[model samples]
Target: MALLPAAVPALRAENLSKRFSTTLAVDDLSLTVPTGEVFGFLGPNGAGKSTTIRLLLGLLRPTHGAAWIFDDPVADVARAHRHLAYVPADVALWPAFTGQECLDLLAGVGPGTDLAYRDELVARFGLEPGRRARTYSTGNRQKVALVAAFATRAPLLVLDEPTSGLDPLMEREFRRCIAEAAERGQTVFLSSHKLVEVEAVCSRVGILRTGRLVEVAGLEELRRLRRTEVTVDLSRPAPRLRGLADLPGVTDLRWASGLQFTLSLVGPPGPVLRALGETDVARIDVREPSLEEIFLDYYGEVSA
Candidate 1:
């Protein structure tokens, strides 16, 4: 009896870098997305997210390192591409072709596609497949690309700003498709700055800043790193919040009207809760930071 070979990762990059003129677009970026996982690439606009995607797809070669798809080097475009399907931020289609014709052409050029699923996606996405590509709106054009990409039989799906031109309803549909793809054991590489989009689907995320990979971790872990805002209102007498100022994970302690206290908590809340128990508390509110707030904390300021 023969032994079987081990399965390869869906995507891998080892110290990948890209330079243009004087600007370094991507610098020493390394990442590994395991097979059958939905991974998110998160960053603001102009953070080299698009450039990095181009490098991975072999549309732009890296200046210093390499990337691979399912063990196939991206430098070998034909072979690497056969294992992945891509939907770019701005999809370009042949103007002369009808929507159906464009889908047909894409299906023929890719590794393969499920015809029955393709037709079903056409209906589910509410795409007018009979219309000429030139007449479609940006959202409609996006639908065509999405329908085609989701129906492909490729092992990996690379989508950049996938919900850009979609309405809220369609965005829900897109999430459903991603869920189904993961269920079918396909890997998805989703690139977007939309915190909602990433938080909804990705189990893990990579935060990119100024051409560098800053951090990569599970969403829950990332949330833990962010400070939680807590407000407390006292009754007649105020207990000493001075001691709370010395508590671990407590910062920005502020008091207002001799009765209200506010502070930022970074770690466990048990200590603060116990401390508050000694105070004459009237009302208390604890607000978890939004995903966008956590994402922004990583950058410190908005990018240009």
Candidate 2:
């Protein structure tokens, strides 16, 4: 039997670092996204997410380490770029060109493009194709970039805060496009602070914090490792919750209106269950925290 060769990853970074003046913008970051996977790079603002993106795009050279778009090194800007399409956080278009013209130009420059799908995207995004770029609003400009990127035949799409000025309805449409891209076997590297958006599309996520890669895991695995929020309502007031206060893996304990107790729990619930038996509980609600809550655990009061 003959062995099959391994497929090249869509994106790869090893010990990637970037520094601006005295500030270390991106610090020793490493990550990989397999071909055709929708991967999310999650972080708060100024967590060096954009810096990392720039480095990957070869717009900024890393102070150390390297990155690749498939087998092409990012240092070879033109070669690496041929393998991916990029939509930045902020988009700037040729003011004199109409929206349709802009889309045409983008399609022409890319490795290839699905022109029929591009037309459909223009309609789906509600872009006024005849309008000059200068007349387009911020959201419209973003739409132009999105339509171009999504319509391109490039294997990988690098999106940085891709939904900047989009309204909720358009945001939903953008997510739909992402699903279509994945269905077509396109790899997407999505960088954003929006937990809900990432949770909706990304199969795997890497959390960046202060220029460093802090965690990378599947959503389910991340949830399992984090604390769950639990609320308990008692039939009547208990004299004390002495055991719960000192209970292992219990934190943020508080008493609410009408004998309600709320707290976060981690690890085994056996201890928590045993303690609750001491009180006359009316109702109990336990839920896995939202992705945003999990994000907050990693960045508390850090302006996420």
lDDT of 1: 0.87
Question: 108 in model 1: Cα distance from truth in Å?
Answer: 0.5
- How far residue 92's Cα lies from its native spot in candidate 2, in Å, is 0.6
Top-scoring candidate (TM-score): 2
Candidate 1: worst-modelled 10 consecutive residues by lDDT: 1-10
Per-residue error for 55 in candidate 2, Å, reads 0.3
Off by over 4 Å in 2: 1-6, 224-251, 256-296, 299-304
Clashing pairs in 1: none
Candidate 2 lDDT, tens digit per residue, 30-61?
89889889999987777888989999889998
- Model 1 lDDT per residue over 104-158, tens place: 9999998789899999999999999999999999999999999999999888999
Judge candidate 1 at residue 50 and give its lDDT.
91
